[model samples]
Target: MSTLQTSINGADSSVAVIIPSKPNPLTVTYKDLVTECSSFQHKLAAIGITNRSPVSIATVNSYEFIVSFLATSWQRGIAAPLNPAYKQDEFEFYIEDIKSAIVLVPKGAYDTDAPSVKAARKFNAAVAECYWDNVKKEVALDVKDLGQLKGHSKENILQAQPDDVALVLHTSGTTSRPKVVCHRSSQMSVIDVNVNELLC
Candidate 1:
């Protein structure tokens, strides 16, 4: 794990992330952030998502994006964030290419009529529904039957090795069809450093 994640001290209650959204900006501390990420990681592993498996996250820019991305990383899984504005066919193409284990839609954004949902079903990829936990002020995955899975999960954080895949991004395909580029953990860790600095 990068120092960013491994250094998270749940005992320290200082604020870590402030998510500005409607109604009110949600303020999350280091403890809450770590807790939610670990929870979601187990939920993901229970659903057959393992290291290197791609999980497509289709949502607008929000706190959900940050939490889900970190949670997926915790599980040693590859996160594939796609544009929510993609049409059904566009979503289909990307999902098929990644062989995504599941497609995560935004909280309160689940609808059978939604393009992401429709495409997930067409490709036999599970549709994971998450909701914003107002009380907890974080994004949560729906994993009711995961009691046993979470219980058996190891507490040790899953650190990224130099060669482990972390993220998969696509080119604009300006010259030809879009090409999928796999980013290794070492590379992403470095990028994360700059990203965190900017966010801070």
Candidate 2:
């Protein structure tokens, strides 16, 4: 795996991240984040997700959602993050369009009003619920599966490259359907270079 070193709020740290997640209240190290991501990655794989397969993560600003997103990326799977405010019909369309293999719903959000849960049942996608208080235990159960994912080339997990589409933002359907935009990582690099040169 590749290692990345960066500073957060003036503190220098080295991180080996397969997926990215918010810091746990109890854990204070980059390793803790990586471990959490790894655990979620294992769980996804165990449930039969392969690289490039579509998976939807539904949550409301919780650590679980972040971990799930990172875990999907780590496994080289496509992540379709949806608005927690979506209704059943909207969710159905999005999930069907992406052909989501699974929908991850954080605990307390699985009630009838939860669009993800409703759509998951309609689309026959596998639904996995994550409880906030039980995150550690759930993560442990998937650790063994995550081990198999390590040691692979890091490049393989990336869904978008330097010149591929990075995000798919939907627009108003009444005026127009969702529009697709293409973005290149190189464009960011070029912008950075120009700004630095101007400053220098």
Maximum-TM-score candidate: 1
Off by more than 4 A, model 1:
1-4, 7-12, 135-137, 143-159, 191-200
Global CA lDDT computed for model 1 = 0.71
lDDT of 2 by residue, 16-105 (tens): 222224563433234555566666677666666665666766666555665575566556566677777788888888878777777766
| lDDT scores in order | 0.71, 0.52
TM-score of candidate 2 versus the correct structure, residues matched by position: 0.62
- Report the number of backbone clashes for model 1: 1
Residue 28 CA displacement from its true place in model 1, Å = 1.6
Candidate 2 clashes between residue pairs 3 or more apart in a chain or in different chains: none
Query: In model 2, what lDDT does residue 176 have?
Result: 70
Clash counts for the predictions, in order: 1, 0
